[model samples]
Target: MSAHNFLGNLQTYTDGLVEEGKTPAVSVAVWKDGQLHLAASGILNVETGVEATTDSIFQIGSITKIMTVSIIMQLVDEGKIDIDMPVRTYLRDFAIADAEASETITVRQLINHTNGMSGDFFPDESRQSGNQIARYLDRINRLPLIHPVGEYYSYSNAAFAVAGRLIEVVTGVSWYNAIEERIYQPLGMSHAISHPMDVIRYRAAIGHFADQTHPEGWKQTEQLYLSMGQAAAGATLTMRAEDLITFGRAHLEGGITQTGERWLSKTSLAQMQVQQVNVPTVSKAFTKGYGLGWGLLHHKQPEDTVYGHGGVTYGQLSMLRVIPKQNICFAILINCSEMGMMTEITNRFLNELASLDYSEAQAKFVNLSSVEQKRFLGTYASLGDGFRIVSEEDHLVAYYEDTVLKTPVERYSLGALEDDFFYGFNRDGSVALELQFKDCQKDGRYSYLFSGGHLRKRVLE
Candidate 1:
């Protein structure tokens, strides 16, 4: 079916989420071949009942990691910094709990999340002053290494915080200003802003906390900000789903924007997406290996790859995906800590767009109606999180949105694979994860996924 056909079901589907109290507000978009498909539903605020739109800005959490990496890549393109250089080269006074690891961590390791440092320290809790990130780096000096640098995969928000500091050292500007100057402005993303106060100038989404006492209700979350201290770790920058896809397109197009703006060298863009570390345990399953801010995703088949990132913050959640081979991108943003809404919406949308094939090679390859293609079309869930595996005309894709814990929901894409039994591969094709589905007439369908060291089960209803 054409993408527009899915739009018909989108409204009804989105209404179900809001009516069910699973989300407060949301904005979603998919971009391909220079065209866009968009949708929205729910309210921006639970109390105000402020209507949401495709333009509604959301706190894009760690999705900002991609923007941070973009700036770093811009610097790489300009020869202002080298990815392999030691972190100490820029922050000479910086120290971590593990002195040796702190001394040896490379810039590349920090971006790919293998820096071996404690990453979640949220100092400057007040989210104050533009100078806070500098202080954050100072506070970071006291942290011990989580593992040997370059030896393991650990998602470190602080690593990105330090990355912001390094951006400051290289560019002579605050990280937010650098992102605005280097990434957003060049791409012509007018509705995107990195700081909290600035978001007030636009139609924005207010994240609402899901009620702990009542699973089906929501209460307003307190206003929050991304302190200049933690901006790189995606403390909370509001963005429209459409604007993010514009950024994704830039990445898919090799650091070049649709308007012909050159954001980074093609080589630098490629460098940022290259798998730099193993992240087999990431719950989102978008990628098995970590790249810069991006994760390399293997679709439902071997050799199929895509790259993307996810975002999360208090009362907010986001997911982004980019298929470079097809120049296709999808972004979903929502307000509310209840991530089940994201799971429901993203799964249906991806499946609806499964037949999208704009390229000639892709058109012939996707042939959606083939018997082989139907084998993978279904919703598979594990541990209350949802994963959708569908046959895109060209390849099989495993779509995921995880809300197992914490603020941000994890949204991911994995390559779907099947032979004698079903399985999945990471974006770089390094890890093989088993996927088992069983039919149960009484209990509905069930999925058993082995991830994060347990067999997580999600029901298909």
Candidate 2:
């Protein structure tokens, strides 16, 4: 399909999703080569009934991590910091459950999420305490590490918290201000911002948690506090999808801003994209890993490596994907509770962009006998997600751990389409659930259960 027609179809689909009560608002943008296309649907704020526009801002969750870490790369370019240097060389107070491991943790390890620390920990800080990078690190000793200092791949939000502090200490300014002075202003990202209050000045989109069955399907949610420690999160960077794509474009072009200013040298920019650690696959379309703050994705077919990131703020979710070789990038921001919808949109769009047909390659049905299926039945978990696979009369029902389940939780009855691929009803939404099993041991032990590009490492069985 032509790019124009593809965007048209995307616009129609997005509008239908919102009008059909699937989401309150959605902002989508596609940047291919030098041209960019944007589309929006539904209201930015259902309570006020503000229609979303090309300029409407939505929080780009962990997508802010790339921004925060990019500044760190700038520091690297200036010789203010070295990626390989141990983090303790700058922050002496940094500590974890393992003293030896703590001393060995490097800036590279933290950025790539190989530091072995449990990445969970979001403490809300009042705006007045914005200068809090040091205070956050002082208490890091209380938290425990999941593995050793540089064992393997696991997502770490806490690592970015410490990274924010590193930025503050080296630059002689708050990490938040450093971001604005170094990133937003330099790149001319006028709509990009880190403060929640600053969002009020614009046509802000209020995140909504919708229960369609409730008397009123939507409930407005308060903006989350972006603590100083979480500067990496952009504390919820509210901005237009196209501008976000521009940011990604800068990285793709070896750190050159649109206005002809060179932000970082080609060497440093390449360092950011090079794969640092092999991470769990999140979807069948791409083999994902961590590279600095950006996600390093290896497309299964084209096998092209792309850098992108996904962000979440309460019920709001945003995603950005960029392929430098093709000069193509896309961003999707939605204010809703159904995150699976984001993947549904992204996967189809990606497949269409590549002119690849998933159905053609869909694995043929292969049913494992009841006795053989036992190996697939178990609980798998990562930091913030998990699922339990149980056999129900020869069929496998995956009880996903979700707070919004109709009962205690939702169960996805999966049927085999390929030897290791399965599809089923993905909630009440239009999207169907597709799952792939990978890295299984010869003895039938699987290490990661990937869906939506978020790898939930096997915690049991």
Candidate 3:
């Protein structure tokens, strides 16, 4: 289906999310074969009565980690930085709570989120200065590691902030400028601005907190000025939905801008997608892996992989995904974050898109007879207990026990039994699948690697 048609469903999906009190506004874009498509539902600013448009910028939150990682990778490529070297070797002031572990931590471990870092050292608080973050890390590092370095998955904004400092120390320039000059400018993403202090202002979108329980009534996002720690979690970035598509396209094309400038080699981009550790205990059925600053979700369904990052801060949530082989990309941003509406809307649209048979859905599957596809359509069970796939209206849908998780089939793309099993979207619009299904059945069914460790359905029905 053309993006135009796909866009209609996206708007409807997002509109329903807004009506359901998930969020007040959202921005979404789809990029394919170098072409860009954008659509949004709701307002960028509810108080100003400003409707969300293609150009509205968003606080990309942790997604900024990718930018930080990209710059660090560039330094690595230049021999200015070493991935395996202890970070203290470069930033002499760098310290960790575990005196011995601090000496052992490498830049690579930090980039892959294996540094044993947490979201925050304090309870019910967010945002920290570089100095404050450094102090907090010192305190947290003393607390024994839940798992040894490179053995577990613990998302850490502090690790990335340390990375930002490393960049600053090595480049002798502000981390913000290094990113702008190296990544944003070369990619021609003029609208993409980092560091809340930048003078560039025009298309930026202010973030909104819809949750009323907080003392501050739904207000503008706090600026991250004079805060190097912001690089990891709170970097203020503003960009239209269209420009972000370009950034995604670069990854799709293997890390080179459209004009053919070699910013990063294909090898480097591949390195970023490498699973540093197996995140068996996260969301969904498939393994959630880490590659530098991005998240690698290998969905057993549709037999494809998605690489990118998702971010959240205050009332905003953002996501960017690059389907490397398909040369397709999607970006989602919302003005409000209470209740996880941004995530739900994004999942809904992507799930709908996933339901479409890429072979026939992408102007290719139209000829496959719906009857011929029925054998693959029966209610195959998923890895999660009581989760199964059933044929609905000639399409494959996912159900948890009796409750449908994803609606409408997005073409059941089965993979080699050895590689992947049962694929498509479940009712919740999440990428649905049962990875390593045969193995699970043989063992009397254990926990599904996905669904963050839940008993899986083993018997096929």
Error of 1 at 22 (Å): 2.2
Summed over model 1, clashes come to 25
- Give the higher-lDDT candidate: 1 or 3: 1
Identify the runs in model 3 with alpha carbons over 4 angstroms from their true place: 1-4, 8-20, 119-147, 211-228, 282-285, 301-303, 356-461
Clashing pairs in 2: 282-453
Q: Tell me the spans in candidate 2 whose CA falls farther than 4 Å from its real position.
A: 8-13, 124-132, 214-216, 222-228, 282-285, 300-303, 351-360, 364-408, 413-461
| C-alpha lDDT score of every prediction, in listed order | 0.69, 0.75, 0.60
Model 2: weakest 10-residue lDDT segment is: 354-363
Candidate RMSDs in order: 11.5, 3.9, 11.0
Q: Using TM-score, give the best candidate's number.
A: 2
TM-score of each: 0.74, 0.84, 0.69
In candidate 2, what are the lDDT values of residues 237-334, reduced to their tens digit?
78889789888889877788999989988988878888888764324555667778888767654446667888877668889988777778889998
Ranking by lDDT: 2, 1, 3
The alpha-carbon lDDT assigned to residue 95 of candidate 1 equals 81
Per candidate, the number of residue pairs that clash is: 25, 1, 21
